[model samples]
Target chain A: MSREVILGDIREIMADVFDMDVDDVVVTPDTTADDIEEWDSLSHIRLIVAVERRFKVKFTNAEIERLRRVGDLVALVEAKQPA
Target chain B: MLKSLSWLRPAPGDFRDQARALRSEMRGGRGDDLGMRLYALANHALDENQLVSLARLAAGACDAGAAPAPFSAVKLGVFGDGTLSLIAPAIAGTALRHRLAVDTFVGEFNRAALDALDPSGPVRSAGLDMALIVSDARVLGLDRPAASRAAADETVERAFGQVRRTVEGLRPSIGSAILVQTVAAPLEPLFGSYDRIEPGSPLSMTAAFNRRVADWAADGGVVLVDVAHLAECVGLEAWDDPGQWHAAKLGFAPSLLPVYADVVARAMAAVRGLSRKCLVLDLDNTLWGGVVGDDGLGGIVIGQGSATGEAHLAVQRMALALRARGVVLAVCSKNEEAAARAPFREHPDMLLREDHIAVFQANWTDKAANLRAIAETLNIGVDALVLLDDNPAERMQVRSELPLVGVPELPDDPALFPRMLAAAGYFEAVSVSKEDRARAEMYQANARRAAALSASADVGAYLASLEMACAIGPVSEMTRARVAQLVNKSNQFNLTTRRWSEGELAAAIRDPARHVAQVRLVDRFGDNGVIAVLIADKGPDAWAIDTWLMSCRVLGRRVEEACLAHLAGAARAAGARALIGRYIPSPRNAIVKDHYRNLGFALEDESGGATTWRLDLDRFVAPALEMTVADGFLAPENAAA
Candidate 1:
């Protein structure tokens, strides 16, 4: 899967977790936790769990901790997915 | 209204879609109506994530000051060795399913010991009715490998001492009860398969610790949240998420939070005397493999020799087990009563007999109405009955009509029936006394007495034929737990409906100003153990009836009249001028709205749906009753005789 597709999927999952409309969940490579008011540590963990479930992939503890932006989640999902 | 209710099966639509719709509906000024809808939605089988969403909605409702009635609110103090902030919302949301509204105070993380030990800590100062200490193996240091077998045994002892101190310290400081959780062992084993025998290993140490905690809790009358057993059921590997634990100090996997919250809430419900009492079963496709009306008794599948037959037998065995543990069984089948009776009477493979059922209603009528009749006959609230049916349509109809009645949806396979019913946690009991073992038999005898009452000429002759004998004594240690259970559970017949714990009852019993009576009745049918409990505040002028409650099973037997006669004589002998009584109306206790009035007490005052009554001793007339009475506590002269 392409990075764009992964980011789109992550955006939908984040919308559900944050209880927001998909249109309001606009995300780009530069989007960070600070950009969303509901993206606290708890919701971040929820987001990671939901994203993993959506993509059928697992994230390492290091990868989960190192995630800093929407781009990082997309890159991780892309790397885990089969080419 | 809850249009549909299903538990074991997946809910109708995607939970997110349902939750979002409910959330929007909540914002539309329909908070109270939508709040119950939300509760019904949350009662479905949902995962942790869905539970979190629903919890958010519930928290929002609370913030908006939307109050849901008929759910008793419990003030809870949650102290844990790990991060419990995530669990607080889950518990608040899940408790709604169990008919409880939990107001929580989550203590400082890893500060359970300090919070419990400190006199004015957050937990103690919160004035909580109950406190739950959540922990895993790490809380007791059992996560680490011990040096030697003797050291491991010593570790268990030390852990037990710490727990004992915490519970005892918090008991006196808290409002009512304490709940301690058993630690789940770590999944990773140092000795592999040999961990079972290796005493110093993490697995063995946790096993020893749990055993010690269970025994201690039983002896101390402290309720237990058995996380160790819950973990084992969910599988240790799935239960433990080392990544999340290291990240946020989560006790277990976040995925299991819904299940964990449910277990804890049910334990709280059991301690609060909110557990259900009856298991109302259906006939076709539920108790047996085939419909008895259509297939006949010979063609129906039950008992051994085949998989379907064995599955049906397992359902019967489950019902029998529940019956053995004080859960009354009743049948609500839509068939001819004769047809339903044929199997239980003559089927060779049938395990349950007609004698086992407390109220057998098998006529072709609406199940919701029949369920109401069953609850009436059994003398319990409709909420105390759980309907186990295989038809989804019938389950939905009952849910819409009588939402209080518990209906657990069955899976398509009959083999999973017992497991589904067990998972519902309807009959979650805290303690089982000898009285509990004989409760089903007592209820059956009550049915027989009812039959005999109808057969007799009049109420006088019925009482005469009963040959009833009564014994009343002080509330002693032997009767404390049962009395407390009745005090908390008896809703319809209770006058004051005051829920007093065993400790409170003990203190009351020791007080010079209080007279506590534990009444037991015996008739030709069987032993009705401790059917009535009365607590009166003694005064020089008059004795005030503080708590007066009776088992509804003994209603219409003139037992209440016998009790009043005994109390009147005891009070007069104690130099009291008169007796005072109060009637407080509850949703379920309208049956006793005119209780004091019917007993010939003059109404003194009325306010806020409660009325006070006074009866002068000089004018009191003790009516002649058929039963013989003995009052050894208040009338000590009778004891000496």
Candidate 2:
């Protein structure tokens, strides 16, 4: 999967989690939890659970902690994608 | 519980769509109107994300003051050593499904012991109706391996002691019912295959600790959450999450939070006396494989010979087991009464016989009305009935019409029917006593008496035809538990509606100034064990009835008349001039609102929906009834014989 496609999937998930329209949610490579109002610690875990489930991948604790932005999640999903 | 039943159908697309619509409504203005829908979605086997979404919507609806009226608001205290921020919403959401609006006070994380011990803690001072202590293996030290068998036993004892102390401390501080969870054993096992035999292993120690907890809870009258059993149902690996625990100290997997909340809610419901009493089953495709009306008895698939037949047999077996544990069984099928009775009467392989059914209503009428009629005939609230039907249309109709009635969605497979019902936890009971074992047979006999009554020309002749025998005596050690059960459970036929613990009953029995009557009745059909309990106080002038409640099964049988006559005779013998009776109205027990008036007591005082009645012993005429009466409850001659 391409980075744009992974980012698009993440956007859809964030929209659902945040209860927003897909068009209303805009995620860029530098978009971080600080950029989203609804993205708190609890919602952060919810997002991880949803993302891992959607991509059929598991994230390591250290890797999940290291994630700083939407781009990091997108890259992690891309790397974990089955080739 | 719903998620554990893998045999159940995946949440239908329409259900998800409906849930989405309701969720969107929460964001919009009309979220309050969606309380019942949100409750229904919580009961469905939805994934964790959907559950969380629905929970948010339900909380919003409740906050908007649009919670349904059938729910009883409960102030719940959830004290856990792990992260409980996520769990409170899950509990509040799942509790709505059980008809409870839970306002939870989440205790400080890693301070379960301290919070429970602190008399002035926020959780204890919140005036909680029930406290749920969520214990995990990490906090209980069940995740630690012991070096020897003695060490394992010590670990188990220490864990149980800590839990017992916590419960005891909370008891004095909160004065609310306490529920504790059994720590789930860690999935990672040492000694591999030998783990089962190794007493010192962490798994074995956890198992031992759980056993100790169960015994202690039984002795202390505490409710066990049984999370270990729940974890086993959905394999331990799935139940526990290393990633979540490592990151946030989440005790269990966040995905399993919904199931955990469901289990705790069921235990709370049982504590609050909201457990369902009856399992109303459909005949065709529910109790058996094939349609009994369409297919002949021989053609129907139910028995030992085939796999399909065995699957159907499993449903009947589960129903019988529930009946044995005091859950009344009834039949409400969309078939002719005779056609429905045929399998139970004629099928050699059928496990549920006619004697096991309390109220069998098999007809062309809509199942919703039949369920209402069944509840009426059984003298229970419609909410107490759970209809298990394979036909989705029938289930949907019942759900829409009677939202209080439990209608579990049945899987297409007949084999999964029993598991689906079990997973629903509709007939969850805190404890079963001796009277529960005979509950089904007594209801069946009551049904037979109802039939006999309709056949007879006169009410007097009908009651006479019952060949009824009455026994009245003081509450003894033999009848204390049963009396307490009736005192707490009987609502419709209860006057005063005073709930007394067994300890209180024993004290009343011992007090010389008080008279406790343990009334049991037997007809030619069967023994209706301890049908009525009356506690009266012996005053200077009259005998005042403190609590009077009879089983509704014996209603219209003139059992109350006989009890009054016995009380009058005893009062006169004790030189009392009159008898005083009080009727305190409750949400239930309205059936007996005019109980004293109908029984010839003159109204003396009326206030606040409660009335006091007085009967002159000098003028009291003992109405002659056509039944034998034994003074000591059980005749010594009969016992000797």
Candidate 3:
């Protein structure tokens, strides 16, 4: 329900998708696709899909392509499901 | 796996939440695991609305060219007069259930009618197996039908003629199947006071169009995709989106894509020949009101006199209708054979007799084994059988042991049996010929031959004893339906599995350059009817057999040799140097793998798993047989009758 809670959920979903530990994955506004070892164009799509599925929201193709960092994804998900 | 399996077991709210999650993920991207997502969507947990929404998203993803769905590709072209791209994803979603990765070519809006038909277009170059005509741009806006039946007739006939021309114009390179959607009745509230939304108005015109199309499509490989029926399943209002229509010029609403996709999926499935050929039914409580053996024959309600009896009667009538359309019906019950046979013999209300059944297994054996035996006796694959039993345990047993076999659960009430079976769409046949109607009788003749074979010394002697007669002639109206049905349905003895519809059969019959012959056999046992079909293309110097197929019952009876002998004569008459025949082997039809060689056809060439054989017309000799041949064009069925 809160921003932090939603971010926490996003972390768990990303961990499952990338097969990494939630603790090993760090989130910040500067955390771009370059920051994640496994992140690429294909995996970026998968990550966006994973986040959308976990949060019950949709990201336009333009929005997905323009996403610059994990913080953008977190902010978008929080904005999508406001309390 | 457990998560998907348990997704449907949750309560309403929980199921909704789970379905939403899966659908959202499925739509977001990553077309991988589409098969699983489709499975989850198919579960009963999701309501119709939820399923439709998910299907729409899936269709969108497909439109954008989603991942190659780790599936066997089924290429298709969706062309229409209006916005047709919205439907691509839903079709892709539904095709996933069949394990078909759909690669779609969306025609330019308003050019669906002309795109595939233009011989030099990209659609023709796609090498598609099938194509769908999404909608006619003017169907909804066509002049409303007047009160008179004649007005309605004129409306539909005009539309049908235009559509027919488009269908017939489809180039040979457009692939094998052309799927046309029957125009749906428009949503209520047509503008203008005279445009009264009455049944005999535009609604009647659309319905009449569908009826005529269905009649015309019976023999033609042209399939009428019943989008109107899908519209009926969901409310007509829900199926249409005028807002989007006015805004995007979308001929169809985006919301209805899921339902429309379903219709496309079914049509595609039938075209690919991915359908069952037989329905194995269980007796006891399934076919009658009670257990026949324990309750005695009279106690089992199956007559037209009582309420419960009528329910069982409906199931029997449905079976009889299916049988009439060439869907084989067999009985698999857990009871004594005598007890089962007694009901058919004694009950006056029994719609199905022992003659109607292709196989009757009424032993206490495991039903799974019984179902398999039925399939084996029929020489069809296990995947081509649908078993219906009242007992849940029996359904579960068949489901677990024979997963390939379809086990459709009937409602608790026996009256719903007919409705349930009809809705399952398991026996979705593409075409039915007079031969199809006589299929049960042909199977009976085979049984008689089997009996005679056991009594005779050898197979050759048994064949010789039976006074077999072969009618070799050009295909006639009476025989065209049977010939096309054979071409479409016969896989085991077919040389090259090329399916032809009735329209093509007529075209071939009229073409002088193509020599087509249909063979009908009748022996001592019974009338075998039209059991074989042969089509050959007349080249300048050679006549090549484009298609050669025979009923399994007539195999090993020298039927193919006799046909070839007659073809050689015809070729010689046409001033051709030789007759050509080729064998393209498949999962079935291995019986005829060496048929060309056995018929004295020299191996002309072999390439790419297909073997081509040639027979010099001048030196070819007909196989001697104790039979009579009715040569030349046989009269149509009606004329003969």
Instruction: List the global CA lDDT of all models.
Output: 0.82, 0.80, 0.69
Model 3: per-residue lDDT, tens digit, B1-641? 11121112222454444545655675686556554454434533232234334444445445334333323456787766655544665576556544355666777534544665677877667776677876542553443545676765666677877777666555465656788877667766454444444445775567677777788766474787877776666667756656555545555545445446655776677766666778898999878889888998878888877888888888899988888877888899999999988888888899889888888999999999998888767656787898888888998788668766777766688887777776656776566556667766666567557667779998778888988988887777777776766687687889998877677789987998898888888898778887788899999799999999988777678887778777887788778999889999765677888888988889989887899998887787676776776666434342221
lDDT of 2 by residue, B407-491 (tens): 8776677877777788878877766778887777776776677677778999988878889998888777767877887887786
What is each candidate's DockQ, to 2 decimals?
A: 0.50, 0.43, 0.06
Error of 3 at A55 (Å): 14
- CA lDDT, candidate 2, residue B605: 100
The RMSD (Cα, Å) of candidate 2 is 4.4
* lDDT tens per residue, model 1, A5-81: 88888887887777676786678989999989988988777788779878988888899989898998898998898
Q: Number of the top candidate by TM-score?
A: 1
Listed per candidate, the RMSD to the true structure in angstroms reads: 3.5, 4.4, 8.0
- Looking at model 3 chain B, report the run of 10 residues with the lowest lDDT sum: B1-10
Model 3 interface DockQ: 0.06
Model 2, position B398, has a per-residue lDDT of 87
The residue ranges of model 2 lying beyond 4 angstroms of the native Cα positions read A1-39, B1-38, B47-67, B108-121, B173-176, B292-295, B335-347, B358-362, B495-498, B501-516, B535-547, B561-586, B594-641
User: What is the TM-score of each predicted model, taking all chains together?
Assistant: 0.91, 0.85, 0.74
